[model samples]
Target chain A: MNAFVQLDLTPLLIGVLAAIACALPGNFLLLRRQALIGDAISHVVLPGIVVAFLVTGTITTWPMMLGAGGAAIVAVVLIEAVRRLGRIEPGAAMGVVFTAMFAAGVLLLEQTDTSGVHIDVEHALYGSLESLIWLSADGWGSLLDPVALAGLPPELPRMAAAAALIALLTGVFWRPLKLSTFDEGFAATLGLPVAAISLGLVVAAAVAAVAAFDAVGSIIVIAMFICPPAAARLMTNRLERQVAWSVAFATLSAVLGYVLAGWGPLWLGGTHAVSAAGMIATVSGVILALACLLGPHRARVGAAREA
Target chain B: MDTGFWQAFLAALALQAGYNSALVAVGAGLLGAAAGAGGTFLFLRKRALVSDAVAHATLPGIGIAFILMVMLGGEGRSLPGLLLGSAVSATVGLFLVEWIARRTRLPEDAAIGAVLSVFFGFGIVLLTVIQTMSSGRQAGLESFLLGSTAGMLYADAVTIAVGGALCVGVVLLLRRPMTIVSFDPDWAAASGVSVRGVDLAIMGLVMAVTVIGLKIVGLILVVALLIIPPVTARFWTERTERVVWIAGALGGAAGYLGAALSASAPDLPTGPLIVLVSFGLFMLSLLLAPVRGVAAALWRHRRFQHDVHRRQGLLALARREAIFDRLTLKVLRREGLIRPDGVETPDGAAQAAKVLRDEKRWDVARRVYRDETIAGRYDGLTSIEAVLTRDEIAELDRRLGPPVSVGPRIAGAVP
Candidate 1:
């Protein structure tokens, strides 16, 4: 129990929060056929943080966020420019831009004299979810102690706030977002700012990605952004139910993945904890696979042609 | 940054650097050419991003291969063994992406993202598990992520070179059917081309390129080699065959240059440098390629705008109206169609009469031939002479007869 409080709780909370935060915007992305935007956003985060570190000479949260946000904007603009100017497909443009940016990020990380700072490609990919331990926790009572609470891993609160903010934004903009995702022309005819809404959705996804990536890794950010929402897509035809299903799947993946990574190896008589971030992503994929096989609405019965 | 770097770069470019650097450079060039050739079909097929999933999916296979090799009492670092394992797993990931996209309602993009992240995550999990093994500390498996050329074994280079050559050969042989299918799947199916079979063949070729490129470009940046060159080549041509060949040439150049640059300095990583070089080519193409480039498009638009303004100004001159639009007057004056004070020069008067005649001919043709095709061609700028025969224009002119004297002398009054 003490180990659970001191070690498991913070990582698990952060993982769950990150998962939910990403999955929320992911539902709309999946519906809108922009699902890989999450992938592109996450890939560019490395460069964003690396540049932020270079300029500020520190890894503070705000600087990293601002840098990452700036990178996401640049990536989006470049993708659009390439798509328009070169007459390339959205997928190809996205692939080109993100890969180049990611390559630049890796090069920068290698060239800079980053000796002591915890900034590198491996750290961005797998994350340090296992190390965000709560040292001040003694047991369950530590949850109620103000001093112990103050020592809780900063990721937990930050992820929680991010997840909460995403949920609130999703709730507030549910109708127009759904309308635009389904029939863009119809939504625009109804006086909706379809273009702005689409951009807004991409912006929201970028925020979720940048916030969640710091804790759970880009792998988890991508998996959560895709797998949970995609599984939910198979499970329902309605948008509201799909969002609810996605959130549940995200929560289940985080908890089950954290537990399996932390203790499942020992249960099988192994030596140490595996990567929590990886396990969470693996679990989410398993969930998606299962939903693909069994979800009632998995077939495109009422679906129209994709744009 | 140093003279030694320059000397080394030039030596590597000439294939006289050393046995190791030359081998690495040749392997990179061959792999880039193959990937560029094979990726043309994917870019045309609109499935270019599938390479990302296939590339990332190779990780778990690498881990499992390492463990299996260790168990078999081998050093567990054979490049062929690792490539074979990676190929197997990448095939599985490709199939999964296909299966999920087909069986479920999720789009292909979602399937790609899902498979990519999961396979990579599972692979990381396996890596962590491998760390528990006694021999895992010296695995040096991380090199695959960014690629390394410092000690590329001769056998490894030979394998990559041979594999890339084979893939490019296969791409050439299969180009006919693959191009047919990529252009129009429904038509290809109707014409007995076996669209599914051709798609599977394209995927196989792409998979071969990805596996072969794993050593030179690494997986994460491998898709860049597949995508950037093809996209860059697209700016220079409209034909698929030309695009494929140009892409191969560009990819080969980028790879060769990148390898030489990296060989020049230990600090230069091969994968990013290759991608950056490729991006540099893509940028040049985007900005300056003829006909399709940004600069060319802007130039075309400007010239088109000038023509429209001049054409309208001439028409207005025929109408004997005072030209007030600044752009119209400026365009007319520049073209020698009007004098200093908006007066029509003799050349301008003749051109305005011709313009008015074409307008009246079009107005008559619209009534004479009400076919949608001919009427639809009217963009207010196309001259009736271009659309109709001489006889047809003569008939329209006969219908209007002797041209009502609009007295264009008002604008060309020779004041």
Candidate 2:
């Protein structure tokens, strides 16, 4: 029991917080049809992190976060430019820019002395979440104590703060975002700064992505940004409920994925567990699949009936 | 900078020196051509990123295939076996995307993102598991994550060549139907073309190309080979046939050049350098293509705006002779439509009269015509006569007086 409390709870807390943070802005992205922009930002942030490491000669959070945020904004700008100038579809434009950026990041990592650094290319790609440990208490009783809380992994508070900022922003701009997402022309007629609101939403998403990057990596960040909102969208039609459901789904996947990753291997006769981040993404996928199959929208049944 | 580096680079580039290098180049070139051709249809269909989803989705199949092979007492590194697994899984991923799109209110992008992340995540889990296996032959499988041409065997090259050729051949045979479906699926369906069948065929070809290109470009970058060449080709021409051929050639060139460069530079990876090269071509075409390129488009827009300004200036001068600005007068004189001393030429008189008539006609139409009639007839009109009926013209004549006749005092007219 002591081992369980010490070993599992911190990672689980970090995962849940990160997932919820991502899901907040993800709901808007899903609504705006920019779900993949989250994916793109996640990919493009690698070079930002690497460059930050080179500049600061440390893998500290603030510089890395700033660099990643800048890269994410650049990614958004480049994607827009490519889409507008080349007359390409947004998805293809994103694919082109983000993949190139990621490839450049890989190349840069290889060329630089950063290869020996803690944030190697492999870590950037797969992540090392299992190593994020925090043991502040002797056992379960003191786990919630102030000293214990202070000893939590730094990622926990950083992710929580980022999540809180995102939630606050979303709450403040909820009406404008909803109006613009559903009807941009209508929002414009209402004299709302539709473009500014949209940009704000994108910035919020980027912030969320940067916050989640160190803990879950880009792959899980992308999955959280897409899967929860999508599943929530399937389950409910109301925007408010969608956000709520998304958060719920995000938390559920985070906790469930942690459990499965830690114990799933034992069932398969393997001595070790798998990647928690990967498992979290997989669990989100399973939830989305279930939502598709049996959500209140009755998608499959309705399609069959229509046919 | 160093002699050893230069020496190694030269040795790597010797044209006839290594059989394996030549084979890898041919295989990559073939794969690029096939991906290019297949990508044209995908792009035209506006499903360019679907191939990315498909490519990422292939990783789990690779992982699962390796485990199955090892469990069954066969070498898990067999190229065909792994590729087959990837193809099957990629097809399944495609089907899931389609199903989700058809069944739910979720947009296609949401569906694609979901399937891509989920499948890739599962694949990563499987890969971690595979790493712990006792067989210890998992080293070759990691190349599928980021392609490495350094390990290309002659047999692998043959597999790529044959698979690529098959994909290209199938594309050629089904070119007409594929084109129809891609451009206008509704029309294709109405015209007895099985839209779904064509879609499946294209998807099959995409899957095949993605699977075959996996070993060379890796699954992550294969979509680049698929998409970049076709996008670049689009800049050069509007014709589908030309686009296909150009894209294929560009893809082959990028692949060949990229492979050679990667071989020359020991530090560079083949997949990214190839993508970067293709990206370079895309940028060049985007800037330099004659008709659709950015520079050309901007030039066209400027010329159009200038022409509009000149026409407006000419009309303003024609409307009020007191405003006979020197520039407008000079332009009219240069065109031999007007003479000096403000005398209108016959050509100038005719043009001025037409412009006056058009102005009067539009004025009457705007007030007198019903909104629906105006919209139906006058929308996108380049000439006033095209939208004006006899009755409307007569009405304009009665309401706005007879068209102003060009006389000597009106403007300078050159004989």
Candidate 3:
């Protein structure tokens, strides 16, 4: 039990928090037909984090987050510019920008003297979820002790705060966001700033991705962004119910995946644990797949015809 | 760090940097060309990120292939075997992407993101599983993530080169049907071209290019070669066929140059170096291509602004309204249409009279002709002569009976 508290508690909570944070903004992105924005934002976070590491010479949290936020904004502007100037469509423009940025990030990682630090391209992909152990915890007793609580991994609190903030913001701006997403012309006619709302939504998604990235890695971040909300979307037509379902699904996958990753192998009589991050993503994908298969509204309203 | 870098770069550029490296460089060029040509269709179809999903999906296959080979009492490091495994998995991923998109209500982008991240996560799990195997310590599979050419062999290079050339050949043979489907799937379907079949074929060919590129550019950055050149080519021309070959040429050049440059420096990785070179080409095209480039667009905007200002100033002068706008006044003076004191020159008076007559002629013509051919042409920029024959303008002129002297009055001092 002590071992579980010391080693597993923070990572599991962080994973849950990260999953919920990403899924909140993801619901809006999926509806707005801007789902790839999450993918692009996650890819560019590599360069953003690497540039931060190089500049700061240490692996601090805030600088990395700031650099990543700045990079996301830059990528957004660049994609828009390329789309408008070159007359390329949005998909290809996004493809060109994010892939090039990711390549630059890889090149920078290889070129730098980062051997002494724990940060690398692989680390950036998978994150340090398993390593964020709270060694100061002494089983359930530590949960009530302030001194023991102070030794918790920073990501636990950070992810929780981000999840809460995104949830609050989503609640605050629910009406305008819902209005613009479902009926843009009507929203504009109603004197809503449609364009600003769209931009704010993307910024919110970027913030979610950057915050969740440290605990769950980028793979889970991208998956969480699309899978849970997408699954919830299949379950209900109402935006509020879909969001509620998505949060539940995200939380469920995180806890279930973390437990399976840590102990399922042992239960099967294997000695080692697999990656918690990978398992979490796989679990979310499983949930999404299940939702696709069984959800009430999985099929399109009419016979399948894409616009 | 020194002149040594230049010497090395020149040698690599000349393909004299030893046999293995020369082979790798040639292989990279061929691979890049194939990716560029093949990816044009996907880009045109607006499904470029599908390649990302396919590329990432190759990881688990690689891990599985290695474990299977080791269990079968082989060394488990064969490049062809691994490439085959990756190809198989990429095919499954491709089909899954298509299936999920069609079967579910998810937009293709959401499907793409879901498949990419999920498959990649599963692949990572398999990679961790492989690490527990005894022989996995020196598996060197990480190279498939960020490719390395440092110790690559001649045989591996030959396989990649041959595979790349074959892909390019397939692209040539499949180009027509692929083009038809990419431009308009419905039209292709109506014309009995088998839209789904052609699309699947093109995606298969892209998978082939991606598989071959795995050993050199890696899966993550391989999408760059597939996407960048076509976008860059788009800046240069509008024809789909032109885009295909032009992207091929650009991809080949970027590949060759990037491989050579990476060879010149110790710190450079081949995949990123190649991608950056391609990005460089893209940036250049974005800024410099004629008609479509940023510079051209800006110039077009400037010229349009100038024309609008010039025409509006000429109209104000024709009406004898004092031009208050600074840009309008400056344009009139700069065109030698007005004197320094804002009065119309003798030549300017004649030009302004012509302008006012055209405006008046358009006014009468719009009311006279109820047809779109006559009235729809009046955008303030289209000239009256361009819209009608001399006879039509003359008929309108006859309705007004006589021309009014609206030009500058050369101080008929009674005013």
* Cα misplacement distance, residue B141 of candidate 3 (Å): 1.1
Off by over 4 Å in 2: A54-57, A135-137, A140-151, A300-304, B1-17, B137-140, B315-415
* TM-score for each model: 0.95, 0.86, 0.96
Candidate 1 at B184: error in angstroms? Answer: 3.0
| lDDT agreement with native, every candidate | 0.90, 0.82, 0.89
Error of 2 at B203 (Å): 0.5
**Which candidate has the highest lDDT of all?**
1
Residues B1-415, model 2: lDDT tens digits: 6886566446545544277777777777888888888888898999888998899899899989989999999998999999989988998899999988887888889888899888988888888888788884444687897787786888888988888888878978988998888888999999999998999999999999999988888887788888889888988988888888899899988887777667765677878777888888888987888987899999998766555544654465466545445665666677766677766677876776776566556766777776876745653224567776787677767887554454445444221
TM-score for chain B in model 2: 0.78
Model 3 spans > 4 angstroms off: A304-307, B407-415
Worst lDDT run of 10 residues, candidate 3 chain A, spans A298-307
* Model 3: how far residue B91 lies from native, Å: 1.4
Best by TM-score: 3
- Candidate order (lDDT): 1, 3, 2
For model 2, the chain A TM-score is: 0.94
- Assess candidate 1 and give its lDDT: 0.90
Best by DockQ: 1
Clashing pairs for predicted structure model 1, backbone only: none
